[model samples]
Target chain A: MHYTEQSHTFRKIIMTKRITLADVAADAGVSAKTVSDVIHHRGRMREETRERVRNSMRALGYTTNLAARTLRTGSAKLIGLAIPNFAQPFNGNYADIVTSYAWAKGYRVSITTYHRLSQGLRELSADAYRFGVDGWIFLTDTPIPAQDNFLNQDRPVVLTGDYLSHGVADTIMFPNVEASQTATTRLFELGCERIGFIGAPANADSLDVTTQQLDAALTAQEGNSAMRLRGHLTALLQHNRSPLPSLVGACTRLDRSDGEKATLRLLDAGAQFDALFCANDAVALGAMSALTSRGLRIPEDVQIIGFDNTPDAAFSSPRLTTIDPFTEQYAQMAVDCLISRLEGDETAPTVHITDFALIERDSTRH
Target chain B: MHYTEQSHTFRKIIMTKRITLADVAADAGVSAKTVSDVIHHRGRMREETRERVRNSMRALGYTTNLAARTLRTGSAKLIGLAIPNFAQPFNGNYADIVTSYAWAKGYRVSITTYHRLSQGLRELSADAYRFGVDGWIFLTDTPIPAQDNFLNQDRPVVLTGDYLSHGVADTIMFPNVEASQTATTRLFELGCERIGFIGAPANADSLDVTTQQLDAALTAQEGNSAMRLRGHLTALLQHNRSPLPSLVGACTRLDRSDGEKATLRLLDAGAQFDALFCANDAVALGAMSALTSRGLRIPEDVQIIGFDNTPDAAFSSPRLTTIDPFTEQYAQMAVDCLISRLEGDETAPTVHITDFALIERDSTRH
Candidate 1:
């Protein structure tokens, strides 16, 4: 839809079957992607090869139809939702909710995944237009820096996650600090003395503290793990408790296996605790498996609290009690914010945090 | 890359920062999408809108730069991986494995999800081009009909799943029948007198069998559930055990919650079985949760086996016994097939199925 060429011979092709880019590529003795590269002048090739491809294009009349018809129909009212690969339960679960809300708001959602974390933010959604979206909603695990102009690279953008966007774009965040604090506080109220924590930016080998020590940690740090750990620490300090490094476990990722292995290592090291505050529900579920496998009972021998409150939390054995950060409402607000931006609301970009609640279940004492 | 326009006065644009589509949109008093539609000639709009957007484009000199620069560079060889959604363990888990293999083979992978089950095959692929995919590897749950041509719409396509493609495209299939049959037969060898099953197409409300009578069921059906069920039935018939309707639980989805509720329903209905053959790992995990919640010992009381030996299976309490469908190998084969097609293999599309094995864990007695 963004381009047009003048005065092409429209009648050079056969009508029996529609000619394709691959058909032209075969005739030119090149790949279809090569033919595409030539069509878009994407990468420079030898002039002779370009002529041969152009000749095949003319002979098949492919350019007049298939190649020229490559423009996406702009009528699709599309929104691009970008997620870092869907291995973790929260990423896919949140994406499903966002797609539903986006569709209900009369827009079709297309997904694009960012893989290989080492590629960094330059690779994070700097190419939304190529994937064909009028705007983008990037639910990222990476932290956005102050000058993160990738936020609004020509399209109205909404950034979600526990990262601080510095208002470079509209942001949606979970109450990583507040809710973790509250979850820890609740475990105390449930009659827990020593509490263990899982998930930090450290490896499973004895799990390093993000700061030199937990007491000196930045409560407003830039990661989900670090911030949540800070909140947990705050609650411990408030209760006049000395920090137990043995009770804190670290994970490389927030996946279930990560949780299970980390929990096993803690148990192997004899890191005893009456309660556990996990990073997310996936980790919590796996930790429960670890505890149960050892004949430990939930809410009696060791109480547990998880975050995110994913569908799995509700169905887990003992019905996992979790911190619900109002995911549905957060999804709705994000869509509305993006729609407002698309509708010419030039107001300064803002940060949005949804309300949180402790969803009590059988995993915790009443 | 398929479009170009010439001789526009680009000097009118501001030199300080790159002009964005939203900027032009704001100046033209239209949504960025509306400006996009006007630029693309996507659909019919009021003539007045067309004129106003053109005026804004001319005024801002946006046409000479940003709008004309929408072409994607063909340098990046890319593939599209389509799955139902990432919420399912198999979907996301399989996708991550495919992405790694695709990247190693020098292809960037993009994802697009198909939501709303009622949308069907017309929505299945038919529009891979609009999503800017060079080719697609569709891991679909929907069955493809005999005359399905969405396989190759100008671009090379590869379809993977239990569903038959009627040789419409290059296919990578799991040995659903053989592996499942083996899984059930092993339970009998392990001295299980009665076996329970979860995951049929029917709902949790007294799960319905596909055929009116189990004996008349089509051994060669089109779905993962039906085919796997047929394999189980073949094993039962081999052992001369009458199929117990109450022991057969049905699930609309193969998610964790669905498995939990279905297992509870079967147990509540007094369906006594010595073993349980679950459809997938997510289902198996949940079923285990249900049994454990009910105070039942794992292998001693009820031997359980699951499909898709996901990472979760290794860490699950009792360490779940599962059918190893060679997911990583399946991913490699699929990538190799697509690459061959891209490099112009020109051979007849072949059906490929990966080998399988029962990985004995604590959930099953060795």
Candidate 2:
């Protein structure tokens, strides 16, 4: 496949021009991709073709400009990650893990806050071409809309969160319901007859959720809140106990302050509970504060469990017992999927659910 | 004001050509920048020149290819932020604020973790052109070395941390010593004496530092640990009290676990202290756990204060009283400085020190 080209004519023309991959390709009588394959030592190319491209590159004096290739081809080795702001420990922990995993896969990450109230994936589609990222990893709280073809952007997308992806993109999630059920069952095993739930999806802030409302939420099953609520209720039902409305504290958001308000609302209603299962560590920490303010001691008087074994959980008073959702593995899965897609993998979109562990601490009895 | 060109010839020439800004400029007898200004409705230009460019655009049927301009010029309007992992609340808070401010100023942020132990700013300069960031803001632990000229990156550099910038880049810092001193003095004003310091920069894990060690560390004035330790000692000295070696707890890091370990070490040495001033809220939380474990009541027996009014500080039982270093303002300044430089401002590198406030809560007396 050695090209018998007249090198003299090509050399003279290249003297007045910056020799590009296209010039090398034309000289070698190969595609531009073959020239690039030879330069990067990547892709399947014949040995004879690689040699011809190399000889042409040397004759044309072509130097590969990394920036030029990126600009001209619009193929920046960059991954855009959209997560909620880092006030929540889960968001920060996930962001930290994603950055390491993205870099390890040879892609730099561009992170942005995906404020759900103000914007959605549908909005990003309007200007996705402007961002210049090869692919995207969106850790969204809301399930991406399938009707809008939100996942059908110019670049491939991989989602990481406890949300349904509508079979549109590669998704990474943890077993929210299963983990919540396991936590609840553990509390019951520890002889806790009345286990309250904090951070249940309330229709409004601090509203007492009715059984009818709970049923509707469960049937819809749109988010982690409903899924987690179902798990808590199932555990109680399996134990031959019915859930009490007062014990099920409802809050619109999952923050420490929200947890505190929920716990206070339960207390004000004279809800007698020996244990609490919160949506996240932040809410659990707030619950601890509310309980402590009322002179109820942890573990001895009331047991508490949190999710997302964040760093704060390890240091919280009583060293909050929490569910370790394996954020590291989840991040790794998301990055690997996105990278594979960028490298031309056309596999069917798959769902990746990471395993979880119950981290026992002073917050709960052994 | 309209261009008086051979309309038929120009229209025919542009009919086969996808009209570019350069084509419009040539038709109007102006520069490409003038055409850009007219399109964006920005920059100071004569009304006649604007009209001429607009008319040329209309006549030549020139549609703006925004992606083409960005790709060819390599102006992505992106800002790179290098920070430590988000396990630390301060890092997360700073990152959250930076994202909001950067977005408000019409720049998207690309974030990466800067591991001080592995890489430095000088290392980034080697590949700054590849990341496509217009400028960078580094939230670093180690002060940038002056000799390396790390500040002379291809993109502008802004720093936000406790470390000195060697006057190499615009730096955002909080008053560590002054804020720590104010926190200590507030405890004293509330009728507390024998205040203990936790999270000093010990040479090794749990190594006791002598007065000589303290003096040397103060003279160095490097990171938050040393600065915070100095403020505690200075406050004691100002109150005509000499700090007892046994009362000062030493730790290599400022994590919550480190705080707990340091508190235990002081207690084991039989140090009698009525108050404690911790390095950060994390350390303070750990200290709270330690005191509570030993039956030491907060405010009643051992009032405590912490630095960095993190979300954890607000929810801790006895609701930790800490110094609010104004993270919002610090992030704002860092992003603004970096954006200013990216927009071609050539002001001398300056130091920005944000103000601090001592937040009173249940951890301290009113």
> Against the hidden true structure, what lDDT does model 1 obtain?
0.75
Q: How many backbone clashes does every candidate have? A: 1, 0
User: Looking at model 1, how many pairs of residues clash?
Assistant: 1
Cα shift from native, residue A39, model 1 (Å) = 20
Worst 10 residues of 2 chain A by lDDT: A5-14
TM-score, candidate 1, is 0.79
The sequence of per-residue lDDT tens digits that candidate 1 reaches over residues B158-261 is 88877776776789988888888999999999999999888766744546553354554435666787777778888888899877677787888788887888
- The fnat scores of all predictions, in order, read 0.26, 0.30
On residues A157-190, what C-alpha lDDT tens digit does candidate 1 reach at each position?
A: 8888778766667888888889999999999988
TM, every model: 0.79, 0.80
Looking at model 1 chain B, report the run of 10 residues with the lowest lDDT sum.
B1-10
lDDT of candidate 2 over B163-225, digit per residue (tens): 777776788888898998898888899898788889888775447878777666556565888
Residue A227's lDDT in candidate 2:
78
Clashing pairs in 2: none
